[model samples]
Target: MADPTSLLPQPNREEDPETPSNNLHHSLDQIIEQSEASFGWNQFLQSILVSLASLFDGTQTFISVYTDATPTWHCTSGTTTCNSSSDICDLSTSDWAWDSISSKTIISDWNLQCSSSFITGLPASSYFMGGVIGGLLLGTLADSSLGRKRLLVISCITMSVAAFATIFSTNVWIYSALRFVSGIGRSCISTCVLVLLMERVGRKWRPRVGIMQFFFFTLGFLSLPAIAYINRANSWRALYLCTSIPAMLYCFLLQFFVKESPRWLFMNGRGEEAIAILKKSALSNPNSEFNSVLLSADLLSQVPESTKSIDPYKSMKDLFAKKWAMKRTLIVMVLGFGIGMVYYGMPLGVGNLGFNIYLSVMFNALLEIPSYPLTLIILEKWSRKLSVLWFCLVSGICGVVCAVVGDKQKVIRIVLELASFFCSRTAWNLISMFTVELFPTCVRNSATSLLRQSYILSAVFSSMLVSVGSSNGFLSYGVFGVAIFVSGFFVAFLPDTRGGTLCDTMDEQERKESMILG
Candidate 1:
């Protein structure tokens, strides 16, 4: 009988030093490239299922803005009792008459507007805070025991439950906590889905499929305004019910239909399972002849020696273990955080831009329509680094234009802000795919989540900035412009990953200490 170890493919040092056994990413890529599954229907179905999480996320994002809307009010008699313009200390039912007594939010219903803006903003902020905490807790699970499919399933369920229970939120405290939990679950869903989708397909097609997946997210974003517009005057609960129900259905759909990532299965020493998946993918295509060699179990287990023994938590620790890796992470996060300000904050501030909140959100969402197809094309035609750089440059310039224009120029302000958001959305799409291409699969979740945490962290401040600048464009748009512009230079410092293969470990991605530097 042949020895099991002897059958393992030995790595040739000279020809391909970076390619290793547990680098199941490339192994899966090789398998797909050699088989008909590279662009097969099975993979297409899988991509569609996986990208649903983004749609869930996009809906959750702007729902709060419309749901938590402040009710319009009027002074009953041109009156004597009201003391100040925005009463910071006192707001009573007697002091104002809601324009529509039937339509209201917790803030208006409870008369919490007189409370500090900090208090009014707490629920939204809690959502971002929970996302930060959740990233620390569940982000690494994608790389280890749970894997991407399980983590995404559990996370989506959590989000759906939280969102559904929000229907019962009787007061501010209960509502805030639920939003926090939803944020926690939504962040987990966002992190895992991208990693799962990217791992499921071949490296060559990764850009095309992954960038285009956000189209579903755009659809989700567009849907919210219509949902809200119809019910904005009736009940905010309607918005929650709509988003939560679809997300609930989504969890079941993913759990039953989706398969565990083949790369993840291979990485965990489930060789037979991974090979079986590859064979299934191969046989799923009707146009091509079957190839048995593509499903070789011997090839699936050829990862680096370190990956076999590396602790999953160590993947998180490794981000800062080396000076270069830490530097790479910080730079990426800074870029993400800088642009993340706009990516995460734009929807929140859309109402501030003097447009109807519903139309503004839908208009902002409209930009994503063009951004998606252009991004898909740009990703294929350009360097990942240059794509980010150009996106930043355009977004930053438009943002500054938004700041320079006057309030009297409402059309100009609207156009400039839209253009800025368009570029920011483009940058956002590139950056999302860039993280996958930039890091190894082992720490891919940790790396992307860390950068995302930075985005959330920046969002914490972006929320504050939005509050401080809601009435003033310069404070928000100018800051976003400057940060994005400088981050573009930081983006240039990172490696260009266009047409590069995915690696399993940082050592493989960098290959040398100097590959990334301070």
Candidate 2:
């Protein structure tokens, strides 16, 4: 095969060494491509370590499904006024009792069974609201200041600490407040971990490694049913303690093992650290002669002017300053909002499925397993636009069917709901990778986190929908179906980024776009 570096974008070193020419501008993608950074065993190991954060993020986000669930109730003996069909809100408190201890769920402990939907959904809404703020507030920091690895570790710790504190919550108000804090912390983990992992590897391994993050997230989601089942009789506090302690310890692993994204380092004018990471990656690859190439090329000197004026807030500005970037960001944000409604809302609304909640959640989580690998396969053949559009359309149809079927066909209803969630998961997974490819590295973290905020912003409403859906299927599934179906069409406007090299700076990406347009 031809030498890999021979095909990469090369800087014009023949120009005056003192005054670098515009020809000297190069993206980190070009540098890594030119360096022939191999996807070696160490790189694979680092990818796993970084992606593991998603596992905990997934667990923390969904654990509330069990901890906040309204426990089943039964009529007490000799209760002439109450029967199985009687609404608990209409019955006397003494006439019916919870199936499990009050401590098993916050709903029972806080006496929220008869409360309004807004009150019952507050904690979850609080969590997603916190995520929206966190993503907008912390998103630019990763791209401009903290870099990816530090922000990832800090986010993990913030979430764990907030979770640990949740065990002490005395009322629904306290619990909701802490959940909001946890949501803020949890917001940055997936975005930072993903950008960090994608930047660490070469283009050949990017898609495969990117998909690995979601696999870990599925594992986290799957773990919930088993953990909740095991702690069925214990206090809801145990759930918080169980997930938080290990996550806190995981931060240490992240701190010691994970390396910052070299692309972020170079883009922000930290040339030495950027070179060190690149050289380390080169050494890891047995086939690489990248170190010698690095020495000869002096790519760092070609760093763009955008990096020299690195302001943490400027990263956020870049997203809206360009008409193309703003339009692309808004379209994807809308797509994420719809997918988020279904992706998150379904699991939270599983109690309304008329099937056993644990079994329903298990099926939903299990369905996510196939979607990632299927996404991998689909992206290999389909454009990101088509893959997301079609999968979301299928999910929307199934969700509408689930709403229409209702309680009459319990089996079919559950099956269709699971299918909807599966397709939504596929679309959700694809759009994330889609967003990553949509923006340059200069604003990639901000863009990814912004997309997540759109998801979280939708999720804020999803919690209330789930509360209402517990009594009305149309409120939850029907709304989710319509939202996603309408939003899926927006994908047609987004430029397909599959198989394209990642751009390191705004100028580099803008130049590429102009060339294609001109």
Give TM-scores for every candidate, taking all chains together and pairing residue i with residue i.
0.89, 0.94
The lDDT per prediction is 0.75, 0.84
In the range 1-518, model 1's lDDT, one tens digit per residue, is: 22233323443556544454443444455565444345778877888888888888888866777777676666554457664364524445566676775346777766676666677778888888888888888888788777889988988898888999998988889999999998898777666777787776666677777764678778888898898777767777778988899899988899999888777777676756766776777776664333544434446446323244557677788888877678888888888888888776667776667777777888988879998788878888888788888889888888888878887787888888888888888887888888887777778888888877877876777676677676677787778788788888898677776655677666666663233332
How much does candidate 1 score in TM-score? 0.89
The 10 consecutive residues of candidate 2 with the worst lDDT sum are: 15-24
User: After superposing candidate 1, which stretches have Cα over 4 Å from the reference?
Assistant: 1-28, 36-38, 78-96, 286-290, 294-297, 300-310, 512-518
* Residue range 1-518, candidate 2, lDDT tens digits: 33333534454444312211234333455567544356766677788899889999989999989998888889886867788788989888888899989888988988888888888899999999999999999988898778899889889999999999999999999999999999999989989988888887766677788998899999999999999999999999999988899899999999998888988887777767877877777776766656654654446555544454557788889899999899999998999999999999888988887789899989988989888789888777778898899988998999998999848799998888888899889998899988898888889999999998999899999889998897789999999988998899999998887666677667767776665555
Model 2 regions more than 4 Å off: 1-27, 34-37, 304-309
